[model samples]
Target: MPKLNYETVRYGDDPQVGASNAKQIFLLEELLRAIALQGYSFTTVTPLTHQRFLLGFDGLAKNTRDIFGWNLPFKATILPPYIFKIMTEADLLFNGGDCFRSKIRISSLGEDLFLHSHFPTNDSHAVFFGPDTYRFARFVRHSLRLFQLQSGFADRSIPIRVLDVGCGSGAGGIAVIRSLPIHQLYELNLNDLNFAALEYARVCANVAGIPVNVLHGDFFNIKNSQFDLIVSNPPYLNDPAARLYRDGGSLLGLELSLRIARHALGLLAPGGRFLLYTGMAITSDDNNPLLSELLPYLANDKFQWTYDEIDPDIFGEELKQSNYQNANRIAAVGLTVMRIT
Candidate 1:
């Protein structure tokens, strides 16, 4: 996939111009800050829900939420002058006939805003944020609390090391680090195969005031490294398009999740924890093959873990696809595994 270039983006056949790299990144952050000052907030929903919202809605944007959150095209006058200028200079706007559409969407998670690919994220490498991101962040926060309470790691002097695999928009790492107590020293590592995602993650982390180390490769590429807390919210849908941000490979979309689990589990330091949030394709017989496959690993005496179905059914609209023909439902699930040895 062609890396999304903030410095020189070609929006259709408009112009061959863009802001300088430093200026573009700074301007993008400024744009987000400006929106934050306005108390703007938008929670991204499933793609189906988003599509439904735009259906029969041909109205122009009335506010920042419409343009940034709802991903609607708007007349230039609708946006504050600075926001408009920043977006244009940063190559973040798509000129649509009579109005402009933001090439990026900002979603609010807790008090922080994250930049992701625009709505109807059909692009293969589109960075995505939705209900699953929210759930994953909550799961991380909750697991962190439990880790602190049960393991006494918070009171120790050892600096905590954290990693977020397939870190789309760096939401998982950002949320985990933000939820950590001020006194706790920690390092955050974010890895993703999508360069576009890494760029977006970098911007989001900068906006959140969180320092992060971005690894621009698959998690398996990081060798001889272990983390105290590793969290991931990987793509878990059996998208027919096989988009990088959607498809989870074969086996009802659980194959990638299983692969990540196997790899991340090995990178857990002693007393470290691995937190995962993904969808499980449940067959008509009500069996979760993903969990069943993971049991042998979690059954080890040296590790302790917990699993939960966060939601019984999600993405019901996907059932019509042949990829999920054997799936009766897609269940949102969470797994937290801690190494005791």
Candidate 2:
């Protein structure tokens, strides 16, 4: 993959960059508001499914969902005048010789909207949001509900410190913050290696009215003492293109997931909980490489953990790749580890 030229900034503090980012986010939020006013809603599917769906439709867009969610090419006249003006102002409208396309896609998670890269995300820094994102959000919400039921969980008044590792689009952290009780205080921290992802995350956070501290770096970049809750949904595919959002290194793409689990354990405070949602390659022999490696780490008395298969088979199409030749299927798995010393 080509190296991403990202200016390593903390919170995008530079005046010029901050101003430009502010304008871009403002326009994106405006666009999202306009879309919601029109009651537009769409759920993003896998890239393959999206392509298959597009094949059944005319290449041109017919509605807000078609133009923005399906990422179809549309003529300038297809959009309402106000929507067109916002896209133009935001510089998100791309001109083709005969048609116009959107530079980004907005996806819906219930009432919340998130901005991400357009379809066919072939770019090295594409911010991805799809089925995995939805699963991750659900896992976070479920975990928070369960956490609230724990003894003494409702008594403490101190704010919970939460972190989301490799928080693309800040979905996991944002979902956790959103699901919390209104009286419960929280400090949300999100970190990602992709600069473009961080930008979208910031915009998503702003639109949701959730305050967040964004960290830009590779895995394990944010140096904090500990967190009351940590969550992640990392990439687990062996992409030939080596896209940061898709490649999960070696070990049948479970390497990054394992590494994240280890790092999260060390940063979890006493009584803290870590929730991970990722894909695990299950071999023909029924061996799960990820759980095997993670079991040893949770053997200590201070930790209690549970692993559940969220989906028995996902990305079945990936079997065609030589990298996954030894694997029978990719399973979506969720791991929850609670520190209880």
On a 0 to 100 scale, what is the lDDT of residue 8 in model 1? 19
TM-scores, each model vs. reference: 0.91, 0.93
lDDT of 2 by residue, 234-296 (tens): 988888888999899888888899999998898888899999999988886467787779888
lDDT of each model, Cα atoms only?
Answer: 0.83, 0.84
Q: After superposition, how far is residue 290 of candidate 1 from its true place, in Å?
A: 1.7
- Model 1, C-alpha of 243: deviation from truth (Å): 0.5
Q: Model 2: how large is the Cα RMSD against the reference?
A: 4.1
Tens-digit lDDT track of model 1 for 1-341 = 11211121222222322345456667778988899999989989888778899996889889998998899989999888888988988889899878999999999998899999998888999998999899889988888877777745664466788888999889999989888888788888778888778777877888888877766666766666778888988888877788999889888788899999988898888888889999988886557687789898888798988899888988898888887787788889999898999
In model 1, the worst 10-residue window by lDDT is: 1-10
Query: Clashes in model 2: which pairs?
Result: none
Model 1, 154: alpha-carbon shift in Å? 1.9
Return the top candidate by TM-score: 2
**Candidate 2 accuracy as lDDT:** 0.84
